[model samples]
Target: MSPYKGNRKINIPISIFVVVFAFILLVIPTSGNTEQLITLDKQKLPHKFSIAAPEIRPLVYIDKQGNIAGQFITMFEHFSEQTGIKVDIKVMPWGRAVQQAKSGNSDAIMPALYTNERAAFFAYPSEPLVIFSGSVVLQHRQDTRKIDSWHDIHDSQIVKVRSMNLGENVGRLFVNNRNELVEVVRIVDGLQMLQHKRVDYVVMDALIASSLIEELKLQDEIKVIVHPEESRLSNSYLAFSTSFAAQFDVEKIMALINQYNDPDKYIKQLEIYSH
Candidate 1:
């Protein structure tokens, strides 16, 4: 049907072309352009930042040479190397760590448990360094106070790391008897208090409790109760301060962190970190 015979012209609506162009734009991304966009995002992230980390064994702690070295520390190192974002670990007391993070003095804090108070300033990631199970520690087998269950410690003098939120079950007792619970700057100090009869129980991470007791030569003195298999367990995460989150994309950084997270590889890097 020679419809376009001898120099004939056909007119088409411009709107159809516009609609087709938009559909292409919505469905497809040019390969090189997409790579450039990703590179731009990574480039925008801060080159370096200080992460306030409390000295907790098997996770983060000051080594003999006075450098923060542990599973979490190694994780930061790996992340920095892979993402080109340097994360400096600043070892400090738990109280001071959160304080620095809140004041915008530090960009983030690591291996922290969640608390309603902390949610105000910190944005937590899904990847965690450790899962801490609460253990009721009593000084010397003779001191005589039973912690068959959490309720048993309602009246006991309990001391845990200051501002460290173990879990709701452990927290309820503290809320009920604020005076009975003493806050300490370090796990070592709490264990020391427990030994000196200054505190009746030092409730903290099971593995950390045993590790410190052995390190402090208190194995003969400190008794750890790991009963009531359902001890309050909390996963510790790398919490980013609000100021840092506002400065850059928190979720993007977190995605980078999680991308490298292989739980087995995590503990393997620290060779000795387990449970």
Candidate 2:
């Protein structure tokens, strides 16, 4: 119980405490040196939705450069600028592309024409992106058949890519009238089929058909029929992956469409791509 002995015991405990503190200091990071790591899930992962042009109509999907068209690039740029979101673009054949969206393979499908039949597999945004028109195409110099009325085309066997609802009304009419329609997997196949007398005619959009004619270098053989106004169509929102529908900025996408879809803007993009 002497003072010196008591002081020595206190000193021993102090030394042990200091040693333990030093060990901890050496092993663990200081507040200044600590770092944080963060990760995101697939849906939260940064990505831009993409859609495809049907294989039957290459021009809608393909460009002069033999890639997806300028329209898509323009669309992406506008949407990105409007929504502050980045997107990845893909152009696939129509049926396959729709299937991709339905299967959760792609985030979205593009330039989709609105039809009740497509509703079961996709999620449509609230805005209409563009209006497109459809027409019938045939050989330029052949004995071209007249389509002054639907009656003229009733008995004629028409060629179209399988699964395209060009004009739902027209389609319903054809179904009601019992018309003969041939389905082809590719637009080129349908064109070739028509050229070789396999079908009486091929139906397609004016822009797309012209693009295909120029693309295939078959200007001498193919031409589009624009009159009689058999069908008028418009595509609303890009079809979303049904599985991923809740993940995207649906309102922002609609806002994007409203902001940049001017006729002048489209023309300027087209002109730039032409060069």
Question: Which is the leading candidate under lDDT?
Answer: 1
Q: Compared with the true structure, what per-residue lDDT tens digits does model 2 show for residues 1-275?
A: 65574335334667888899999999986654242111113224333565554543432455557865566566667667655456766766667878888888887777676677777887787776555555544543463665545445566677777656656545743676466777776677888887677777777655556666776776666555544553444454567777777775655555555676642222111101111
- Candidates' TM-scores? 0.69, 0.63
Q: Largest TM-score belongs to which candidate?
A: 1
Can you write out model 1's per-residue Cα lDDT over 1-275, one digit (the tens) per residue?
A: 96576887779999999999999998889886577557846655676788898888766888779777876777778887777677788888877888999898999887777777789889876666556655544545557665465566666688888756656555766784653878887777787777888878777766676567667777667776544553545566778888888777776676677776644332211112111
Clashing pairs in 2: 48-87, 54-94, 55-94, 56-187
lDDT of 2 at 10: 32
Stretches of candidate 2 off by over 4 Å are 1-47, 56-67, 77-84, 137-140, 144-147, 166-169, 176-178, 214-220, 231-233, 263-275
Clashing pairs in 1: none
Q: Return the lDDT, model 1, position 207.
A: 65
lDDT of each: 0.70, 0.60
Model 1, which residues run further than 4 Å from truth?
1-44, 145-147, 172-179, 227-229, 259-275
Instruction: Name the weakest run of 10 consecutive residues (lDDT summed) in model 2.
Output: 266-275
